[model samples]
Target: MPQNIYLEDYTLVQPHSNFVIAGGRVFIKKWTSLSFNCTIVTGNHKPTVGLNQRIIERLHINDIEKDVVIGEDCWVGANVTILSGTMLGRGSVVGACSLLNKSSPPYAVLVGTPAKIVGVKFSLEQILKHESNLYPEHERMSRDELEVLFEKYYKGLKSMGTDYLSPEEKMKSMQYANMQYKI
Candidate 1:
């Protein structure tokens, strides 16, 4: 398929430079929010090419073009820069001013230049508990998967309570009714 920007419902990607500088392809899935001053670049200039040809060569080269894919329920903080070929997993949380050049796992908390996985957004128990009733049975994160992530990025049983889920009704099956869907 041809490369193009594909935005699903409830995804907010702030305007980038007012114009497409590189015309790179981007796909932002649902429930994702990108903050201000963020840049997602899909085009990379070939270093071997001569100065004059570098700019033109990047657009022509088949391998130089790569698309950026942001998964669902991701929150990308302000001043972040995501380079080409980056795929942020679902529920990824990138901190402000981070420079992400590669992909990330689900619920990863990324921060700093050349963003690193600082930690996961929530503890394993909390995440599992939170996702149980919200997402469907099949769509929910499997225990095996969560366990592995727990070993890797898990800290402790943090924020496992539902007190923050005020109004209570919001923790139901995800539908189109409650979302703003746009910035």
Candidate 2:
């Protein structure tokens, strides 16, 4: 309902969804789903040294805002808490009762507190198929990158930001949605 909140066609938020959209934007792309009792926070509380809690609260001066993004076709499970500045990459599967605090790679299957990467939602071939329908040919991940991502996942390594989307795409998505995500 706010100007800073952008939901593209086919975005879904189920019952009991709570969003704290403060100084920044919250962008959800097409086909993303948020399950029940999900909480998305787009801002933080400022710690002021001298200000009283009631005064700060009454003045609304204790807010620090940041963007939040849920990428296309992501599945966020029930009772999840997505914190400020987190980006759920395209087709990510977030496990129920998880706490997500950081950005994740595309197609990742995330679970547990702070949402560690446990698996990938699809194989490389399947990912290719999935992205083909959701993204343009130029935007899809190359076979080499897919292989690299799989290797990193297997080795418990981190994914390079460019493995899923480009910087230009990230900027565009941010500009379009006034929200989050990056390459």
Candidate 3:
């Protein structure tokens, strides 16, 4: 059983049974909030040639294990089930009763059974300002200071290393991408 769990500061997790099990890691970064009845499972029974669903009968097959990473400033709502190999990036918000089975980019607002990215919590510019304010006590910065801040903070969670697209731009991109799916 692997016991390499990393929970950072200012994390709030509500009471629940079997919240996190052993045999893998669960890294919940700083400023995260997990609501009640949330389960983070890190191991799953591997499918075998035999049609036995019982673990005892499938003992010859090894279980698949992977880490679950919930990044900083995240909000996981009630009854969320995060499976193995899932990565919820920084500043994400998972809505209630969501089943997160895939990785998400930073600041993604996810909902539904498979947990699709609906939107982001804040704009990149605002997030940059928020991060700058966090560095030294929440205070406004001068123009030059802001420039320096951007230079340093651009590499961090605030910037996804891409241009912040407008809604129309996003729609266009999605439309272009969806063309591949058409028969």
* Steric clash pairs (candidate 3): none
The true-versus-predicted C-alpha distance at residue 169 of model 1, in Å, is 10
lDDT of 2: 0.81
By TM-score, the better pick of 1 and 2 is: 2
Q: What TM-score does structure 2 among the candidates reach? A: 0.78
**Tens-digit lDDT track of model 2 for 85-147:** 899988888999999999988788899997999877877777776566557678778889888
For residues 14-34, what per-residue lDDT tens digits would candidate 3 score against the true structure? 889244544678888877889
For candidate 1, give the lDDT. Answer: 0.74
Question: What is the TM-score of each predicted model, taking all chains together?
Answer: 0.76, 0.78, 0.67
Q: lDDT of each structure? A: 0.74, 0.81, 0.71
Query: After superposing candidate 1, which stretches have Cα over 4 Å from the reference?
Result: 1-3, 15-24, 49-63, 154-163, 166-177, 180-183
Q: Which numbered prediction scores highest in TM-score against the true structure?
A: 2
